[model samples]
Target chain A: MEKAGIPVVQITAVTPVARMVGSNRVIQGHGIVHPLGDADLPPEEEKELRRQLVQQALEALKREVKS
Target chain B: MRVVHYLNQFFGGVGGEEKAGTSLEVHSGALGPGRVLEQALGEGFQVVQTLVCGDNYAVENMDELSVRVLEMVRSAKADLFVAGPCFNAGRYGVAAGALCAAVQAELGIPAVTAMVPENPGVDLYRQELYIVDSGSNVAAMRDVVARMAHISLKLVRQEPIGRPSEEGYISRGILRDELVERTAAARMADMVLAKANEEPFESELPVTVFPPVPAPPPVRDMSRAIIAVVTDGGLVPLGNPDHIPLSAATIWGSYSVAGIDNLEGGNYEVAHRGYDTRHVLEDPNRLVPLDVLRELERAGVIGKLYEEFLSTSGLGNPLGNSRRLGREMAQKLKGVVDAVILTST
Candidate 1:
């Protein structure tokens, strides 16, 4: 889909499968049940954690230049 | 040369689809199509025995049945193996192709089979076995058997099989090495120069397929680009006013967190039917991190969030549906959203 001019980043628990399937950019997640959150972490901690991950996604969107 | 032949129940004349669960039974002589095939083999090779099994039973028990079939063929000590010109019968074609491939691998025998080009078997076994072109159904049986017999004889004698078009067989995507007057570098140069001159030239190599999607050029500035978050996580407001199905959902609803700082638990729910939604219902953030995206927005890390988020639940999705949905969603965001983060569960 990215080849058509849209930039796409995938966040997945199955990082290997994402890589293998040729997902352009991928961010690893903790578990299949909840991709972006740690149920055990406090709200602030979870927010900070997700912030870093989202930040990666944002940076990934900007720098991935392969056509 | 001795040859072992394979057949499914109906082709073996044991019974119709009703007997598709029948056990493996070996007959000492040609049965049904094999009789004609044996005749076509002429005096040089003989159809020593016919191996029969149910199509349903063969595919359903592929590993066990293939091992058994190999044992039966091995004991025959056949120089070659032949299976059905199963025509358009899907199950029977699969059985014929599979058994032929197994025979070649297990007994080290030259094996050949025939089936319609559209047969699933052609795709699976064409590379391993020289699959002669056959008719869609039994009406082309005689012509098919003749071609198969001719190919089998060539294989039995260890003669080189020609290209798929020349030999009347489906391409297994095999590249045959042949002596050519043109050198490799010369041929490549000719191809390039001809194309540059707007002349037609056939590619020497098969098309390179399944190339990975290249990543697009990265965003030059994050603080000024509109980033959108999309999910297959099935996010929805508390009541799920859009009624996106809990599973296999194609309906994605965009609720306003536009003004909200963080998604409060109980205000949102995960409508996905794939996983236990217990944890997600307590906090939808687990599936889609709107809370964190909101934080990013406040910190000016991103220019702006595309006001409406996109989502659907596809924990178990067909490839066709996934592709279609992707196109549809992408179309919606084409000119509006600058970048996408697609979250998959």
Candidate 2:
């Protein structure tokens, strides 16, 4: 989508793959299967973790990236 | 010369789409297109047998089918194996290419097949088989079969194959030492002069060049910018309503998230097969943070969240297919979304 002139932030557990595929901005994800939340944590804590990841993604969107 | 021809059920005169589940079967003498192929092979070459299988069955059970087909070809004591001029049939092309590759590798027989370059089979087996680039036109079957026969002859006689353009096969990307008239310095100088004069010149080493994509400007205002979420995590509605493939997917779907605060496990499912989906199955929110996004939307941390989320399975996805999916999603979000969060697995 970067070619379409829209900023895109990729969240992935495998950062190298994201970079290889030429993702502009990447945020380290939690794991391969569960990128946002950890199921082992209690529901409330998992929600909190998910919230933090979303917040990080929001921050990534706002940050400027090199061309 | 003895030849074994492979064909799909339709070409073998069994039936149409309804017979796509037909298992592998062998028949003596040329069947349907095999006769055309046999005639093209000339007076000496004879099509000893024709093997037919359903496109669906061949693809679904490729491993077992290829093995059994190999055994049959071995017993036939065939001098050469020729599979479809599959044209544009993806499944048939895959089956033909796969079977030919196996026959050539295992039995040490010269094998040939035909398909369009865009067929997924081309990418998988081009290097292993001399796949004739049969343009996607079934009406040109005679011409395509002729080309397949020509290549099969050269392969069987152990003749050096010509350039892809001359031989009408897809380039296998395999380089070989070729005797040229010009020395390295002379060739380099000539190429430089041609390039400097703005004349047409072909580089000896062709390189794949990708177009540069400039990064889009960052979102300036966090409080009043629209954001959308996209995922390659293969999150889909229950029962996989869209029927997207588990791998090598060619389609994407947008599911309505309106009025939905959280993704309950039972309401959604993971359609990708590359990773262990148990974690995502336990909690769909683990893949898509809809609950948190909704909370943030309510808190007014952002202006608004897109009502629908776009999803596609990325496992074994090819560049051509994935690029289209991305461009389509981008076009849909063009003026509506100020930024996007694409989660990948």
Candidate 3:
């Protein structure tokens, strides 16, 4: 939709899964349980997994060209 | 001509169950049961060296054992390698069979072994190496060793040995010479007659299936587009707590992300069947990385991201179901997303 001039956003739980599912745009997250963050696990681990997942998602949004 | 012989701990005079942990060692001259092979082969063939390893040792460490055995064969300068008349002992039979196969594959040697038909190894390695049928217990030792030695002699001498069945060994299923019993025309006529009579007829050929391809949809204007991202990867609720069947997935569910920034933890999960779900379950971001797409959206890489992410389990699902699911998903997202990306596990 973005390629043709529409606004869009993508969210995902796992970085590897997203890579395999390759998209012109993407978002990264910590995991599948709590894509943003599960209340479980050490706050750091959850925060890291979530931070990475969200970071990938944000990067996916910036791709202006779709190849 | 030099020959190498392999034997189990018991046959090598290394004791019984107590010696099961014995390691491999090379000894010159006939040792234990190897003496039988030496006498059977006569003065023309010398059992130059005997390589013995416990059956358990070989089975538990196949790679290491094979390397040691191969090194022994190379150093012994043996022209022929013969393994056990393993009888019905499963581990021993398997070890002997495996060693023979490894020797043949690595050194291009004509290797031989013997086993009772009931030994599981007979069925497993029969096609890969030469295996002679023998009595089910050690009592058949003399006869089995003699037969194996005889076959090895012929192989070493490069003499003409008959087919496996004629030579009293298990059939290796290798078609060496195709002897035509009847002409092609005669066989075709017999086949047609059998078919006409409604009798079961085996065709000399196979039938091929060529399915018709569906026509592609008309191209849409690139300017005004509604693109969708669809996947059969089964991304769903974190609780998946939905418990979608793994292999035979027949259901599909869509999670609505309308008015949402991105898929959040506890909100989404992966239902893909082909891989370990632990990682993706712990963090749903693994399956659908919405954060990256959100960033791309901010940068204006594309116009819009589809509101709902489509998902289904892809593991072992029939091609028919996949095709139907693909077409249905495409139809549903047709006007919503101008172009689409489909992901598989």
The CAPRI quality class of candidate 3 comes to incorrect
Among all windows of 10 consecutive residues in model 2 chain A, the one with the lowest summed lDDT is A16-25
Model 3 earns a TM-score of: 0.46
> What fraction of correct interface contacts does each candidate retain?
0.78, 0.92, 0.03
B1-345: candidate 3 lDDT, tens digit per residue: 788989889888888988888989778877766788888887877888888888888799989999999988888887888888788878899899988999889988789999887676775688787798877867778888888888887877789877765687876656565677999899999999999999987665543222322222322332233345555567787666557666667767666666666556566666665666665555454455455455455565545667877778877875445545655665566556655544444
User: What docking grade applies to model 1?
Assistant: acceptable
Which residue pairs clash in candidate 1?
A: A61-B219, A62-B218, A62-B219, A63-B218, A64-B216, A64-B217, A64-B218, A65-B217
When candidate 2 is compared with the true two-chain complex, its DockQ is 0.54
| Predicted candidate 2 versus true structure: per-residue lDDT over A1-67, tens digit per residue | 8878889888889998887777888899999978887778898998887788888888888888876
- Which ranges in model 3 have alpha carbons more than 4 Å from their true place? A1-67, B180-345
**TM-score of every candidate relative to the true structure:** 0.50, 0.55, 0.46
lDDT of 3 at B44: 75
lDDT of 1: 0.79
Per-residue C-alpha lDDT of model 2 across residues B244-265, encoded as one tens digit per residue? 8999999999999999998888
DockQ of each: 0.43, 0.54, 0.04
Ordering by lDDT: 2, 1, 3
Native-referenced Cα lDDT, model 2: 0.89
Error of 2 at A57 (Å): 6.2
